[model samples]
Target: MDEESRNGGPDSRQFDVSGAKINILSDEYDPTVSLISSNEKWVEDDEVPRKEVGTSSFWQATSNTVALLLGTGMLALPYAVMLGGWSSLALLAFFAIMFCYTGCLLGSCMKENPLLTTYQEIAGSALGLRGRILFTIFFYVEVLANRVGFLISVGDNLARIFPGVESHIPAWIHLSPSMTLASLAMLLISPTALIRDLSNIAYLSFGGIVTSLVVVGAVAWTGTTVVGFNQPIPFANFGKWRFILGLYSYCYAGHPVVPNIHSSMREPSKFPVMLMLSFTIATTTYAGIGLMGASMFGKETLSQITLNIPRDLMAATIVLWTTVLTPLTKFPLAVAPIATELESFLPFDSHSTAHYVFGNIIRLGILGLILAVTITFPYFGSTLNFIGSSITIITCIILPCVFDLVLHWRTIPKLQLMVDIVFLTAATCFAIVGTFSSGGV
Candidate 1:
């Protein structure tokens, strides 16, 4: 498809492509009506005078990317190693490298079409409306799943920090300690989700990075000085390879938000560098904590490494608190794109009073749904595994390569084409195996 066809027609008004408004027509026409009516038209006109709304600097973008990649999933890496064996570290490394490459592929896809501001838009541009819908379902579900996982993690770590808190609950309240803590966390996080600009939350993202480092340091200290790494780590265990692959896939589940981060960058061209730095830092942290926690606890490791830390130790308290903080900072970032997309479907202009009120309502509604899910099926590891296997593989690995190939098939080099096909096939296989394994099918 040509640029006009891919983006929509020349006169259509698109939504959420950019924050700034472009008033091509005079004061006679109602932009809101046109926006609501032609929201499906995704094209940007070259002739229209438009302004870019991106304001994030290189470091801020890098920080957001890092925070997005290294979420509650990091806590599960050691447990993942426990399942797949020590040799699974190689699989972790492979995913880290491949996801970084695929993330760059997303950037490339965005570069080819500047109007493509969301992951769904990238799919829509490549494979049309059906592709966009397919990706939208997977991407939104993945974001919601991540939010649920975050609340579950917050609850898990908080219970670790304050043991026996569950006993204090009144008989009438009918809530577990983890559920209560997660409810409180949801209340605190709901406000941040209302912020429209990614740049505004960059500091929170930086805070997440700091808290992650502290968690990693705490794990290292516990392993080296407290627990001692004497447990034997096997070379390989093919039995749980499916689940292991899903866990590794979960670590790099940041691609859905990549376009938003790229669009928010002051220097979008440096996105590849941002991806490199973000992935490098995240991979190192994952590897360090996974190796240390697995070698220290082995078969005894809990789903969350924070849970494995000795509760009696002061360091465990500090680490648990930091782990609690990590997800609070990340929940907003993960849900931002979903909120933006939901807001677009509303019958109002972007950033208007109606939009603001309804946008907050949408975000709060999303949090409510997440809270309900967290309270109901509070299985952290299973939730992450299902999300990674069933949805994340499609969003992070398969779709980027598919979009790249579809958009640049004729011009793409033969070598790159072959590589994309290989990635597509492998990711498909991994998704099938991991999904069935998670479902016990």
Candidate 2:
């Protein structure tokens, strides 16, 4: 490859499958980099000028990372355990550790080239323009699918909270109560998508973390007092192992945003520490809720633990409301990176009045697209299963390892290279089997 192609310079712009020009190095226009070279060499840890890099504190970044990981998928861990039996918790822990390691690999890639601010840039830097485009497509689909699952969760929980809501909908509308509620939620969250800064949403992300803990606590309280955890959970059930793997994979669907969170940190070198802390917290929460809910309602646990809680109990009310609130806070964080990338394609200066005018239009268009998909295929469990099996596995488990191996091939130890190859092979197999299994769901 030529020097420009090797470095993924701006002149390397190419057309995607959809016939749209995608500039993989579009960050060149970012004001933050006006004084810095895009091709600068990796700096030493102590050599990085932390005061010039970012604005977010360590805890704020931690909160954002936690919120991103512990989304609608966490609520389904109990159902995953039910499907795969008691042995599945082991798979969950294994995935948590492997994904955390891969996440740190991504942080290392960013550290290798501090100018790479997005996941696509990392891909382009390592594997060239095609890799960048492919990763972009996979990452965007995962985010959109997660948003769809969020709407589906909101619809299901809202319908459960008001059992008579379907009957109240007009016959002419031909919409189910869950669909109506999801539509309303789409409208409610549309405004937040317009926010340009991640720092502004930190508190909202923290709210998501708080609400997740409340839901977990409520599930525990209900399981102990109301449901009586005396049910028999099977030791192993390999019949649905494919679907179970997908569910576990979906729980770690936070890798795409890791780059964004890393970029937002004031001390980006500590990103590995942030990843370890966030994954530890998320894994612990998933395990606690999964064990408790599955034991209490083994073979009968709903896709969302909140769905299994007794409707008449106070714990159920708290769990239901908190579940509803969790997605609202997270919707913006999930879509912001996608929005920024889409806006970069506009034919105007990044700070021009024309860009501002058309940017809000683009954001609204994204919301409209998400709303349409959510309404058409509103099956919560099946939608999540398909996405987790197919897209989530690729983005969260497979690609990070591939990118890291490509970027650090020569310098990485022989054993570490073997480990990345093993992970890549296993994740690919699981993704294929799980996709085929969950595709029929």
Candidate 3:
């Protein structure tokens, strides 16, 4: 293939992934997110360099990486265990390990195709043109749906926090003014539009984690007494099918983010470290939060979390942070799909006013749609399951390994092949069951 044909994006822009330095990966939560922000141009800051952010420190990346998948998913994890039983958590741990291995595969993939810009590109490399078309088309659509779900949840959560605001309007305003405003506001801050790369988003990501930890701590203290730390952690039953499926689904949620994150760095040498660190922290956080929720509330756990604990001051703080920062989660999700779509036509568009304006309009629509869906579901489990499960299956489990193997199958190390088999098998089964269980969600 000619260099230009191979490199031209749908928009006809050069693929531009020249270095091991990271390209952008859009957010995992895509459906209802704003895409405009994903196009923001980055200007390298010599004064504040990569070394400042751990200089590719695995531990540092690990800390942020764990927090990456730690949001809304953790809040519901404990309850999933309760619904499915302790066996669910045990099963989930295996999925976590599997995802981490996927993370390693992704890291290795980056080492080879440091310029791989999107999941579709990686998939194309693996299985050829058909794979790229299939991967990109469905992936973007699913991301679009997820952005909608996330916006709705944000509205529902806001209403829960501010009864006054809810009273000022309808009790169920998933598509309410508040959601409209927040989504619009986020559209304005398109991370994609920002000059910094994916790592730059890490700045906000770290801050979000601090707030989440505080909330986790608050929930932990108020609820569970940890009556049995040594209570023979139950042996997992992968045979239960449904429970195993759910856990695997949760762990694989972070896989779609690999290509861009891996490629967008000074040195891809430490990509595996980032993935391992991220998953390890993520698993521990999920377990702790899940254990606390179950031990404390057991069957009584509230949907979308019953954080109605009576800490007026702390509640206000967390509510503010979650509401404000939470909106940002969908920014990358919004950006990725639009970027893909934009590439499909009129590929020469750059950072003109027309680009941002058009980008913002799409962003507003996507976010508005998310708010609308939440109005209907109102429950976190439903949306989380809906967007979370679909994306998790396509991007996280099946695609990553398939793509990696496609590109490197001729000489893939035996060890990597085994990891690929385990994750792909686990992901495929979970996707099949998730389709059935969440068919109507």
Alpha-carbon RMSD, each predicted model: 7.4, 6.7, 7.8
* lDDT tens readout by residue for model 3, 298-358: 5665444434344354654575457445545545534544553553353336566666666
Report the alpha-carbon TM-score of model 2 versus the true structure. Answer: 0.80
User: Which candidate number would show the highest TM-score if scored against the true structure?
Assistant: 2
lDDT of each: 0.75, 0.75, 0.53
The C-alpha local distance difference test score for the whole of candidate 2 amounts to: 0.75
Cα miss at 11, model 1 (Å)? 16
Q: How many clashes does the backbone of model 3 have?
A: 37
lDDT of 1 by residue, 1-441 (tens): 344433333333322211211111110111122111112223346765322646677887777677667767888999988878888888888888778888889889878766666676778889998987787677567767877887899998887777788888888988888889889888977888787655565445445556677888888888888899999988899788887677788888867667767766777889899889989988888988888889999999888988998899988988888888866776666666566666768898875899889989998888899999998878788878888887888888998999999999999989989989988898999889888887431
Candidate 3: misplaced stretches above 4 Å?
Answer: 1-55, 112-120, 164-206, 224-248, 260-270, 306-324, 328-360, 413-419, 439-441
What is the TM-score ranking, best to worst?
2, 1, 3
What candidate 1 gets wrong by more than 4 Å, as runs, is 1-64, 111-118, 171-175, 187-203, 260-274, 329-364, 439-441
Candidate 2 error regions (>4 Å): 1-64, 114-118, 188-202, 260-274, 332-362
Better of 1 and 3 by lDDT: 1
